[model samples]
Target chain A: MTEEIIIAGFGGQGVLSMGKILAYSGIMEDKEVTWFPSYGPEMRGGTANVTVILSDTRISSPVLHEFDTAIILNQQSMDKFEKAVKPGGVLLYDPNGVIHPPTRKDIRIYKVEGTRAAVEMGNPKVFNMIVLGGYLKVKPVINLANVERGLQKSLPERHHKLIPLNLEAIRKGGEILEAN
Target chain B: MGELRLMKGNEVLAEAAVRCGCDGYFGYPITPQSEVMETLMELRPWETTGMVVLQAESEVASINMVYGAAATGKRAMTSSSSPGVSLMQEGISYIAGAELPCLIVNVQRGGPGLGTIQPSQADYFQTTKGGGHGDYRLITLAPASVQEMHDFVELAFDLAFKYRNPAMILTDGALGQMMEKVELADQKPRWTREEILARSGSWATTGKTPDRQRNVVTSLELDSEKMEQNNIRLQAKYQQIEENEVRYEEILCDDAEYLMVAFGTSSRVCQKALEVLREQGVKVGLLRPITLWPFPSKVIGEMARKVKGILVVEMSAGQMVEDVKLAVFDACCCVPVAYTGRMGGILPSPGEVVEAFEQKLLKR
Candidate 1:
């Protein structure tokens, strides 16, 4: 099986972290995973993106014109990547930050206040975790427990206390999705 | 043969060097290949064996350290990315000039300068054609995968010793950072101390014995006559390498009308393209130069008589294609200058390479 996703937004929006978390989770599951950041002048601050490929087999090229899913966090990201999404693919948008929405005729679009959800959980850094929670609810590639373990393992010892709040954030994000 | 372990290409080469009983590793940290140093540091192989590991101040010192250890007639190696390798060229030339056997690994990144931190096979010509100086050859090996990184280390060391010349592993960051399931090779017999001494004792500067004269390992020949003789000896050794150590990999060329020339990561991508083209009934083939030095001239020279044209793909602006043209000279039966390239860390896709073949051969 293979899963390819693009996490995109302006710099400092934590889009790259979502990609890293997904890739790290895949590694924990004994899957072949590669995380490649878009390089050169493309990353100069207008918009930045990362491509995460998780597969049972080797990943060939890191370039992707389209993704299986796109987690767009800002207006620029949505405007740039929405058309590249495959027919019937999903777009997870951050309604609190992204002002523009896709007008495409063929795709499932979910607009959640991922940033607000993260702040409500008492940690703004858990914005990536909230997205992960929604992603798990949608895909279920692995159990929520595995993702929790992955988060613990991903951080160094100095940041160990942050794991619990991130876990709570994940649970809260899932509840938000449930209420919606 | 054994179970596969998930490892980066740089780590694979480090472990391979240890298994081959490499006497020492002297390297500085550089991106795309920092894991090589990290792996060697974590291994701490010195606790049991006497293998020395030192991080030098620069590539200049590291290559010189290899020069010293190799004079002791033991296996020694150093690794660097492109810029570092460029810095070490004078030392590399000195090692070749003095006839020392050591391994140099170039985990290539894009460059005419500090280009970027990405994989590129742009160092092909510098590696193949005496980048350091004065009519000499360093046996070069290009690996296409993490598995080959492990497998090629022993071959590189053995050939370096056999020819008493430096050998290089030409690789890139993609191969370096990439994690893959790799099979570790079983251990084998290594050269004994006496055997090493016998092979390299002629001029190792090991100190004077009462029974024999002192030896020095230097390329300095003050007299023009002596320098001429030294150049002649170097030429003879290079001729022997050309005859015996030309290594290459050919794939699906049985009825190929066009051949794709590539090495390192580009070769891996080209291999994927070749498979696809064959499925589409395009008779595409690949000639991947494993030893970029010796140039694999004989193969291309012979192919010049058979194929319609050769499509040379690289990560740089047409460097190795120059070598390919030099290899096939006037016997150019086809449009040999065909090139498809991208710069610094930007790798050509298998799809991009497939189109190169299709445009040149299938559509024609």
Candidate 2:
């Protein structure tokens, strides 16, 4: 199976890191993964996006025009990637700063109060993990065990203490996802 | 087995250089490719492997440093993006003239002049056609994936030393920034001074010895006839490389009616387009040139005779397409060769490639 995903949001929203964790999880499961980021000036406090692809076979292209899933965290990303999602695909977003929500009829949409959940958890940095948790709950492409392993691998040794917290945030995300 | 991990192409380049026993790395910082030097500094290969990593003040200084280290038979390298690479053209020409073995990486960004920080293959002409002045050719390797990015470091070094000529890894911002699973080569020990003497002592200016004449490294020759001789020798070496070092990959070409020629990032896009077209019953194939300097003209010539048309895809106005046309001309084939591309850091999508093929080749 192949899953082409795009995760987009503000630079500090952990958009790139969430994709990195997902990519690491795919590697742990012996799947081929590619994480291509839209870098340069756009990443410096502007809208940042990363395209992550996981496949059983060799990935053909790292840059793509369409995605099987689009995980959006901000209105800019939602507006940019909402139409890029494929029919029957999944679009997960956190409606924190989004003024206009996605209005796609063909794709399945889900909302997670990532910023609110992270604030409640007393760590705003874990907002991305919550959004990721909501995505995993909806798609179930990768298991939580693999994701935990992914978090361990992607994070440095000094930050290993935060893995449990991130896991908690992810679970909280799954519990709070709302169909839209 | 080698160590496996997920890494960005630029970071993996630094890691591979360290693991491949590279003697030194000298580079300046540039967008889309700054990670190469940053990772090297972070790894502290100087402390671990006795490898030297230095950030030169400028691109010119960095390349000249590579030239100086390489003249002594050391495996030295430098990396930069489009604009910075442009600044190194003179040094690169001098390195090629001196026939020094060194690695240069151009993680290309779009440019006429600091155009954008996004990835582009516009440097194809600058790289494969001798960006620097005079008649010189660098053994250019285009990596389409992060895995190839890791593998080509050793390969480029080997080719550079084997031919006593400079080699380059031509990549782009996309590959440089993209992360993928890579099986890194095991660490090889840096060459000892004696090993350098044994391997490259014949020409390298290692040191004056009692048993042999002093080895002098210089591209300068005041005598006109001697300079002519030097040029002839350089040309002969390039021809030899063309014969022995051409590398490329062919996919689904056995029964292809049309062929797509691309390299580096464009090749990856073509691969995706090939799949989509095949599903729609279009008999199209992809030819990815791994080595750009040699140009793979021979194979393209042969394919040109069989395919009804050829589509040249790149992230430039049109550079590699000229080589494809030349290949077709050499083969005495009258097949139509069309060019489609994106410039200034915009990568053409797979749908665009398919549409270009259908519009330029199929309808015509």
Candidate 3:
């Protein structure tokens, strides 16, 4: 099975890191993964996006036009990537700051208050993890154990103590996801 | 097995160089490829492997430093993007002339001059056709994946040393920036002084030992006939490489009616295009050239006789297509060879390639 995902948001929102964690989780499960980010001026305090492909076989092109899932964190990304989602695919978004929600009829849409949950948890850094939690709930492609290991692998050794907190944020994100 | 880690292609290249027992890395910072030097700095291989990593003031200086290190029979390398690579052309030519064994990586970005910092294969002709001048060929390896990016480091070094000529890894910004799972090479110890003397002592600029004639490394041949002889020798070595080191991969060509030729990032895109065309009842195949210098002309010539048409795909305004046409010219003159390319770092999608097939090759 191959799942192509695009995660897009503001530059500072850990859009690329979330995709990195997901791709690493694919590796943890003995799968092939590719993570390609939109580089250059688009990454300078503006909208940034990363395409992550997890496949059982070899992945050909890291740059893709369509995605099985589009995880949008802002209105700009929602407007940009809503139509690129494949039919019967999942489009997860954090309802916080998305002025115009996705209006695609063919794909599945889910909203999780990831930013609000992060604020509640007293750590804004876990916001992306919460959003990732929402994605895992909707797709369930990668298991929690692999994702926990992925976090451990992606993060620096000094940050290992924060794994439990990030796990809590992810679980809370799954718990708070609302179908819309 | 070595440890598996998810890394960007540029970063993994540095890691592979260190692990492969590279002696030194000298390169200037360039966009889409600075990570090569950056990762080397962060890893601090000086402490572990004694791999000297230095940031030179300019691309010219970096390449010349590589030339100096390589002349000493040390495993030295440098990397840059298109514009920066252009600056190093003279130094590269000198290295090729001196028969220096070194590795040069071009993480190509789009350009005639100062183009966008996006992926481009425009440097294909420049690289394979000898960018600097005066009769020489670099063993060019084009890597389509991050795994190959790691693997080609050692392969390029080995080929460079075996032939005593410069070798290059021709990649693009897309592969440089993309991240993938890579099984790294086992850590190799750097070559000892005794090893260098035993292996390359005949020509290496290590020093003038009392027992042997003084070894001199020079590209200057003031005598016209002697220069002609030098060119002939370089050509003979290139001919040897052409015969022995031609590497390519053919995908789904068993029953293919049409063939698409591509390399590096374009090959990956064409792989997807091949899948799409097959789904749409088009009998198309992909021919990916792993070694660009030894252009795989023989394989393409054979395939050209069987396929009805050829489609050349690249991130340039048709460079390698000239080689493709030259390869197939004598095989079948009637068979049409069509070219489709994206310039200035624009990457054509799979659907676009399929569209090009219909427009250029398929009959309506």
RMSD of 1: 4.6
lDDT scores of the candidates, listed in order:
0.79, 0.94, 0.93
Model 3 chain A scores worst on lDDT over the 10 consecutive residues at A36-45
Per-residue CA lDDT of model 2 for A50-140, tens digit only, reads: 9999999999978788999999988888888999999999999988899998998999999999999899989999999999999999988
> What is candidate 2's DockQ?
0.84
* Residue pairs that clash (backbone atoms under 3 angstroms), model 1: none
Give the better candidate number (1 or 3) by lDDT.
Answer: 3
- Cα displacement (angstroms), candidate 3, residue B6, comes to 0.2
Query: What would the DockQ be for model 1?
Result: 0.17
Candidate 3 per-residue lDDT over residues A1-180, each given as its tens digit: 999999999999989999999999999999999999989756557999999999999898776778899999999998889988989999999888799888878989999999998999999999999999999999989999999999999999999999999899889989999999
TM for every model, in the order presented, reads 0.79, 0.98, 0.98
Candidate 3 lDDT over B79-188, as tens digits, reads 99999999999999999999999999999999989999999999998899999978889999999999999999999999999999999999999999999999998899
Model 1 residue A53 distance off true place after TM-score fit, in angstroms: 3.7
Q: What's the CA error at residue B187 for candidate 1, in Å?
A: 9.0
Per-model DockQ against the true two-chain complex: 0.17, 0.84, 0.78
lDDT of 2 at B165: 98
